[model samples]
Target: MTILHLALADDWTAAVDAGEYRVSTLGRTLAQEGFIHACADLEQLRGVAGRYYGEVTEPLVVLAIDEELVGCPVVREIPEGAQEAFPHIYGPLPVSAVVQVTPFRR
Candidate 1:
């Protein structure tokens, strides 16, 4: 059960410096949608990047999160009757939860 999140290099750096990372798309807070968005696996991650960040040219990074170190709840969400689910964090993600950070380039 590996879940990942894509973040701009600078954003991730800032999060590490601040000790927390918040969802960026919707007001940069969990209150906007109640969770921090994430992808279930590589394929799903690529799809999300293609769909929403295709035009992005800035350096990016793939954050590999260790759920137990998250310091908060991690949930998998799918629509009613849907088979595929996405991973989301119920609160801000601490830098410690991210076990690995890899450069993301298309």
Candidate 2:
């Protein structure tokens, strides 16, 4: 199964720049499957994450991933001072907060 990740952007422009997620050979091998990345705005991601996590909540990014890949999406949030990664989460994120969305395959 393929696992996809959705990381939220700081703003609308960031969303556009985020574009689609891609997986290289190394990434594919690491994931042990395919991967895709997507971007969504805070409000939109909030709605999706709200429904996912139950009740209304805000998330930095809403990740759409497959069941098999749920536990191992391969890619995760980059730590501070490790060189900013694309589709990075900006602003403050709560410790209790995570914005992974259910797989919405098209």
Candidate 3:
């Protein structure tokens, strides 16, 4: 399964520049969240972005992750009231697993 993660373009660029992608959120990481949050599909992506990042002024980037190369657990579960289950990677996210990344705006 290919999962997607919405990341700030600056964060993504910083990781690419550092040769590793460790920051899990705009301020935290897997250490704090226990998982690298991602979405199962495109529909979920839009809602997630709008709900959690609607006010973000910086550009957002959608990271397309090839689940097979993740080398870690990828679990899907719905939150308390969400209609859809989301894929979450339970470990550090390796940049190599990201097969593609594109600009996102809303």
Q: Whose TM-score is greatest here? A: 3
Preferred candidate (lDDT higher): 2 or 3: 3
Across residues 1-106, which tens digit of lDDT does each residue of candidate 2 receive?
3223334333322334544232322123213433333223344434434444353233333444333323333344433553423232222222223335443321
Best-first order by TM-score: 3, 1, 2
Q: What are the lDDT figures for the candidates, one per model?
A: 0.82, 0.33, 0.84
Clashes of each: 0, 2, 0
lDDT of 1 by residue, 21-102 (tens): 8764422666777788898899988877997788888888999998888888888889465468988898999888899999
**Pairs of residues clashing in candidate 1:** none
Error of 1 at 18 (Å): 0.4
Q: Residue 47 error for model 1, in Å? A: 0.6
10 residues in a row with least lDDT, candidate 3? 18-27
Record all residue pairs in model 2 with backbone atoms less than 3 Å apart, i.e. clashing. Answer: 8-61, 21-37
Candidate 3 lDDT by residue in tens digits, 1-106: 7899999998899878776666666667778878888988888889888888888888899999999988889899887887778888888777888999999967
lDDT of 3: 0.84
